[model samples]
Target: MTDTTTQKGDQMTDAPLLTDRATRLPAGSPDPAEDRSASTGLSVHGLRKTLGGRDVVAGIDLDVAPGELVSLLGPSGCGKTTTLRMVAGFLTADAGVVTMGDRDVTTLGPERRPSAMVFQNYALWPHMTVAQNVAFPLRTRRVPKAQTAERVRAALELVGLTHHATSKPTAISGGEQQRVALARAVVQEPDVLLLDEPLSNLDAKLRVGVRDEIRRIQQRLGITTVIVTHDQDEALSISDRIAVMHDGRIEQIATPAALYARPATLFVAGFIGSASTVAGRFLTGTPATVGADDTVLVRPEQVTLCEDSPLRATVARVLARGHFAEVVLAADDAELRAYVTGPPPAVGSETGVRLGEVLVYRDGLLAEVVR
Candidate 1:
């Protein structure tokens, strides 16, 4: 299935982003009835959506606390964006409730909900100045000229794009343009913030910088935020918690540490990080609880290489990975990958391998964590 969220230019790769009818910038104005003082926590219950006769988002329940940043992470077509859009009021849920703070906004349009979204494509109008772009949403609401200008100035300053306030979208760097998009969203001061693949367009170096900047700004504002991302590293680095989705349902929701240390299901184990699955009998530790029906997950960090150990393996492949080498070893008919620092053994060399702490799964569910 084609991804409905991710996109490049006008062509979409994932879910389509919401935009103004006349321009590519975001739509919606602040609703007069929205309670600004209400709880900012975001909650969704029994959300469901079907597209092309197939379930795109199947029964998703999520809660994002006020001032918390949670990421909806999964591969494309897994419905992370679909779920986000439903919560954002862009896509209506088949059966569910989307509540922000104390408001039940399931029937409200995007404009009426107290939420703001940052588009993945950074949909700033090419003809508009950065300040104008940031102030566009405020203008939609007929905000006073003085307040709009003040908000625009403050937004640019917050994103550190004050000097580029007068520049057109075509003139600024991609990273700067992305900041402009974020600034536009931040200026709204909405209770809930939604971002659709906010950093998918940036290069590696800029991604880290902007990601940290976003976290800083979100923390400063204390807004409830949800970010949809396919990048595990991006989610792990910024999110207070991550909801790992697969097949239109969330398989697990936990902190970065908990998700990495103990994934709830078989899909989560392979999705959150790298791992090698081996039969329980091949595992060197915890023989009492491990059996033929058990499968052991060996993370790269858990693979130990010591010359004096009794376990044996043949070096298969050594891959350079900048800070460390990913050494693939052939052991007991399974390939175990280890992250080795400094010099690594050559191919075809016999070496000692030992399993450290590992997760044991049975019937595709996390059965035990053998430490």
Candidate 2:
């Protein structure tokens, strides 16, 4: 079940050639032509894992273009971290192949692979200074003393920690420690960088700062980066593309805007952003009629409230957000939420409800309609 090379035959085929020259396909077969091209910076093929007789990662495939920052996003135990670890060479896959550029490193150990990883705990040695920590990788590779110092200094500077080069991990801030971990990883100039929830330990105020810092550094280095995180905001804010995982399978992989606007699955629609589901049925190909069985997903921003719209609803509650007020409305056994930028509407007041860009789903699948 271990695939170690990329097969060149039939580029349009979804079947992947394993090390044993066997074709492995995922459940609910997806068209091979539909998968992203392998000209990608990183390609994962038929990744599968089992723990205690339970499939943890079931036949996952992904492609990350060169210099593309892709995020593996999902709730806890959704195999995001497990997939990251398999790519980093920390865990062996029960079935699959991992490729970086033109190299197949599926069986390669972490130290031997051309990739670096930043752990969630920062993994900084308390006794070592920032410079020494960053220099550890170069020293392991038997790099010249002068070159090691130069690379360490350059990495520290890249992360804006030049002033704290001699500082201990305890003396620096949490964000700074995270940077040190990043500096250490970048000093190696790895072909790919795997980040496992690197910002989860920071405070909310500091999270934004570190998030921006990481994105800036990644872009500056032009390194192929894959971040594993469960935070929707974190993935949406920085990733070029996001892979939404559910129960060890990728529900959808698309840009943030596409994922928010046209989700491929019901799980992705509910997981990636704030949404309210209302029962509805498709009146036509493009228009849907509210019903009791079908589920219609409406984003808060997609619902509009006006004084004279046709549909009337009673406001059940209003919660004020910074720039907008979230008003919950009940109409015909359907509960809808809307984001109003203006003043909050009075509770229990009758208001007109208008559907804005409604996305209809039936049987937990996206329904295509021609407008």
Candidate 3:
């Protein structure tokens, strides 16, 4: 279950590699046979992979429109990175077709495909200067000196590393090193860009800034892109769309707003955002009380504290969360968490829990009980 063949160092937690050959980075210019049009899209159909006799990626199908940035968001061992590797041609699919635009690239090698990947560890050679690292892809193809130098300069400028072009990767900050990795990935002007947990190594504050820079660069390039990350915030902020994966399957895929507001499964509802699940029944009559068969998802930000309400609970804890206070309440043998802006009710005091916005499901998976 340990893969050392891929260039993305420690990028995939413990996924097994079927091959020992490392996926070589793209060299020189894009493939002339590969369409470099603005309309070129990336598609994967019926993709499946097995490692160590276990199915890691099971029948995954995804499509990314040109100029769109999509993220495969999932926790460890969920097969998100495995799927990305297959798309990048680092891992061959056990079953399925990977297509670029109208051509089937299911059997293509990593270097033959019109795609570039930014590795998790920033994969820059420690001995090379920033400009040299960015230009290495061109050098691999033996691109002319003038063209390589010009492309390297443009790539460095795109990632805002122009001033540090002569500096070795070890001389720069972690964030700068990441930008250099990005520059190297995009210097070839590939039709698609792949990012493998591209910001996992940065500090919390730096991740925010670097992620923004990535999104900005992606927009400017207008190339089809796929990013893999376990961080929901990173996925939500940088992606035009996100695919939530679990247990070797895609749970849901949608835009950030839609995914957050209307999660398709209980796993997604709970994973994409914070939620407190309370099991109760749907009242049939007017001003009805909660019954016992249904489960309700109450988002903290949607709940409010109000006086003179039918539903009551005991405040268990109160926490100040910068812009709002998190009030934890015990109600009907379930804990209800609410986010409010005003002073919170004292702990151990009785208060009313408001159901301002709630999603009720009849079954554990797919029945919509209420909106």
List clashing residue pairs in candidate 1.
3-13, 3-14, 4-14, 4-15, 5-14, 5-15, 6-14
Give stretches of model 1 more than 4 Å off: 1-34, 170-176, 284-286
lDDT of 2 by residue, 226-273 (tens): 998999999999999999999999999999999998998889999988
Backbone atom clashes (below 3 Å) for every candidate: 7, 0, 2
lDDT per residue as tens, model 1, 1-371? 11111122223222112211111222332323333442479999999999999999899999899889999999889998788888878888999999888879899888777788887788899999999999888778655566567667877876678999999999999888988998888777777889999888778987888899788867866778999999999999999999999999999999999999999998998888899999888764555588787888989999989988888999999999999999999987988999999898999998998778888999989998886
User: Which candidate leads the pack in lDDT?
Assistant: 1
By TM-score, rank the candidates, best first. Answer: 1, 3, 2
Which regions of candidate 3 deviate over 4 angstroms?
1-34, 160-164, 167-176, 282-293, 369-371
Top TM-score prediction, candidate number = 1
RMSD per candidate (Å) reads: 8.9, 10.7, 8.7
Candidate 3 collision pairs = 281-291, 281-292
Error of 2 at 122 (Å): 2.8
